[model samples]
Target chain A: MDLRAKLALLADAAKYDASCASSGTEKRDSRAGGLGSTEGMGICHAYAPDGRCVSLLKVLLTNSCIFDCAYCINRKSSDVRRARFTVEELVRLTLAFYRRNYIEGLFLSSGIIRSSDYTMEQLIRVARTLREEHGFLGYIHLKTIPDAAPELLAEAGRWADRLSINIELPQVRSLKELAPEKDLAGIHGAMGNLSGHIAEAKEARRTPTRAAPPRFAPAGQSTQMIVGADDSDDRHILGTSDALYKKFGLKRVYYSGFSPIPDASAKLPPAPPPLLREHRLYQADWLLRFYGFETQEILAGGEGGMLDLELDPKLAWALKHRALFPLDLNRASREALLRIPGLGARNVDRILAARRYSSVRLADLARLRVPLKKVSPFILAPDHRPARGQLDSAGLRRQLLAPSAFAQAAKPRQLALDV
Target chain B: MYSVTLESPADFAGWREAARGLLGAGIPPEAVSWHSPAEPAGLFAGPPPPDVPAQSAIPPVPRDFLEMAERAARHSDPERFALLYGLLWDARRAPGLLRTPTEPRMARLEAMARAVKRDAHKMHAFLRFREIDTPEGPRSVAWFEPEHHIVEAEAGFFQRRFAALRWSILTPRRCAHWDGAEIRFAEGARRADAPADDAAEDLWRTYFASIFNPARLKPDAMRAEMPKKYWKNLPEARIIPALMQGASGRVRAMLGQEPASQPQPPGPRRRRKD
Candidate 1:
């Protein structure tokens, strides 16, 4: 196929991976002699109609895989159109797109063509060429093959800013049932190996080194799990994510709502994308990372191991634990202040800073643009207090669900909740 | 009241120099009126204040206040300089006024600085560089319209990122040019001066269209980040309407099609060493 057709096919095949991060990499600039630079913040050069950031040129080297995973559109049994780009074609395409400011860098992945080792070598060749031949210093994320040799994995890390190995399913039983080829132990083993190298490199940088610390995926590793594909609850999914964060020191864990695809396998029926569930999962994930919330505490706010569809994870948690209400805004610790609904970390810091000089009040919160209607009942300020029985009223949850225009239009079921 | 006219709309340095003289002269914020070139002088415009030596030492303010004031001064609001000066005056008296983010005056300044920062970030993300052949080799030119006076402030970002190439970013208010070595500021030019399109955009549009999944259409989220104001300049935005219109039908077709039976197992091609 030609370049345009190849890009179209490969990018379409790669769209399900759901990772476009280009941030958190070591800073580099082209002034010293290169073609690009990466500060801390990743810029979304464009947003696709899918509402996803197009930070990097995310495409697979080929869509021809040897394994037949059921949920995947590019399974061996599927009759989808297949295409592959030659190493030169891929390299030239990346440089062209980067020069035009169309993308931050390339995110290269490939299906098992000849073998795991061979596929990895092809990916490495593309990255090595980009770094050595062209001096391209932009962000590069490589999808490392799980079963590839440790030596090959090390080489991949040297040239990449970030590396990833997808743990496609949350539970190993489902992974075995759906994808017979993938092994959970193998995926974790690869992640463990990468984490060790990343940690070692970070430690080396801290101490004085004669030569610059050997670069090995300075941005660290991340992975994706396909939600709604298996019978895994939110508790199970979060438990797996917590383990990955603690054990592997992952930078991110993407939860992609399984969407319908053409030429689908007969084993699993197609369904509409669980967009709201995916959004709630992200909110809960944020609380786990930044808000000092434990997984069990977040899960306790939900029913049947699933997050409430109408309320955000934080509000749900706050509603469930009504005893924690009326926390003093002026004197609450940062950790306690973070648990209050509608108060983001930034605004919490502002409250902490402002309270040091003067007593914080409801008016001050309003001036900071905090949602007073949502936070007032949960917080106690000098000028504001929950009315008698207001916090204990059974209708409080219903009152707090302020159906936004977008939410009302997107979810017709929200109207049914009123009845 | 003393009237002071700044050299330009985004002249933070001039405003600072004048404010320092006024503050050292013990002039309160209400007694002095600030004006930029864009803002016409009122009927009661007074003569420029006379230079006065410091009667007493000007109290020290936090470094954060200076940084915030510098950014807020680039805002298009005519009262930005006066507001910043008022904040500075209050900060000198209260000592900790700048740290109180909830204070109304400090909050307003912070909001203006945040807007300026967002405008600069949008310019960095949305500016599309189109290539044009030059005698030197190839030069990339981009036409962007920023909401604030951030072209000069944000030029270093593009220079550091694209230092190897000769490029020019042209906005309506100001322009920045980088010639592989040094960055130069020039008078702004009309949008027609930049190239209309680049040959590489066809593949880019294709990739943008193909990467989107019809089942997960969320145009509102896309618009929230990439607003409609930027659509006209982006090459791929031309296909957005068509894509959104055709998304439902495409999804219907995918769901309506009968599931394909599993393909017969192929003969083993190669044996694994493990």
Candidate 2:
């Protein structure tokens, strides 16, 4: 098949992975001896119809697979047309795209073909050739085969800026039932080894006495968990993510809702992917990482372990814990200010600085571009105070709720990682 | 009242020198009018700004205020210089005036600086380079229209990033170029000067189409980031309307297709002891 046809099929297969980030890596440019540059902030060269940023040239080496995971489009039983790109073709394509500023770099993943080690070797070779031969100084993210040998995994890390291994399913029992071939223990074991190497490499680079240590995925590792493919609740999914972040120090845990595939398995659920559920999960994830909210606290904001579709996780939490509302804008600690619904970290810092000079008032909040309507009932400024028991008013929730399009529960057209 | 005429639209140096001189001469911000060449000249404009002494004493302001002033100077607002000078004059008496956004002068300056920063960031994200072959080697050229006078200020970013590549960025206001060694500036040129198409764009369009999941179309969100003004220059943007038009039918087709189970190859199940 032609390259275009192969790209169409392969990129279609790869779209389900849902991670296109090219950020937070060591800064490097092409002036020295390479063909590209990455200066911290990832650039989205274009936006897809799905509203997701197109940062990298994400594709698979091939869509043909040996393992028949039920939710996957490229499962061995799925009768989709398959194609593979020659290693040289992929490298040439990446360079061509990079030269025209179409992408930051390449994000390459592959379905298991022949064996785990062989598939991994092919993936590593593409990255190695890009770095060694062409002197490409761009971001590369390789999907590591969880069952591959440790030495091969190490080599994969050395070549790429970021490495990932998808958890696939949130629960181990779900994995056992649907993807019989996947071993959760094996996946965790590989992640444990990667975490050790990544940590050690970082320490070695920091030590002044140590010679320049080799880089090992400076952007760190992230994973994707397929949501709505099985009987997994938001609580269960977040619990899994929490454990992964603690155990492996994951940079990100992407939640890809299971969109309907053309040739889906008979046993798989015939439901559309829960796009809003995925979005709510992301909001909760941000709260977990940035807002210092624990998993239990976030889940408490939801009903029956499902997030409120109408309200964001932060606002929902504030509504559920009404006693925590009406925080003093002038005297509240930075942590307390962060819990306010309309206050982001940036705005909170501004409030902290502004309050240092003088007591902040409602007019000051307006000038700072804080969402006055959403925050008024929750905060007490110098010149403004909420009415008695305003937080406890029955109509407060109605007033706080914004008009959300996803509240109507439309079946999303496709699964994307925008959230 | 003193009148100051700046050399260019984004003349931070000229603005800074004039501000320092006016402050040293004890001229209040309300007693001055600032003009740039890009703006219309007043009928009875005052003479050029008076020079400051070589060892003139300029009062120290907060570091953050200086940074904000530097960015706000690049704004298209003709009054940005006067605003910063006014704030500087007021800040001498009210030492902490810059810290609070409650002050209207400080708030307006902050807003203008944020606008300029966003414009620079958009330039970084939306610049699309098309390949153009030259006698020296392959060069890349892009055409961009910025909302602020940021072309000269943002040139260092491209220089440090794409240092090895020979490229030129053309805008209606000004243009910048890098010849693999040093950076240069040239007069602005028309869009017709740029090559209309590149051979690689077809494959890029294919990738864009294939990667997009038709089931989840959010054209508004896409427009919010990429914006309609930038669509004309983007190669893949030509297909966006058609893609949106056909998204629903495509999703329906995928949903209606019957499950086609292929024969399973020899896989991991047999090897695993489950």
* TM per prediction: 0.94, 0.94
Off by more than 4 A, model 1? A404-419, B38-45, B54-56, B257-274
DockQ of model 2, rounded to 2 decimals = 0.33
lDDT of 2 at A189: 93
Clashes of each: 0, 4
RMSD, one per candidate, in order: 7.3, 6.4
Alpha-carbon shift of residue A233 in model 1 (angstroms): 0.7
- Write out fnat for all predictions, comma-separated: 0.63, 0.55
DockQ per model, Cα = 0.35, 0.33
User: Candidate 2: which pairs clash?
Assistant: A413-B215, A413-B216, A414-B215, A414-B216
Off by over 4 Å in 2: A405-419, B40-43, B257-274
- Model 2, range B1-274, lDDT digits (tens) per residue? 6778888888888888888888887788888888887874579887766676756767777788888888999998878887888888888888789887667788899999999997897788778889888999999998988888899999888887777789999988889999988889877788988888899999999999999987766665576567888888889999999998887777767777533222111111111000
Q: Please provide, for model 2 over A237-324, each residue's C-alpha lDDT reduced to its tens digit, 9 standing for 90 to 100.
A: 9999999999999989988888778777877787665467776787788788878999999989888887887777788889999987
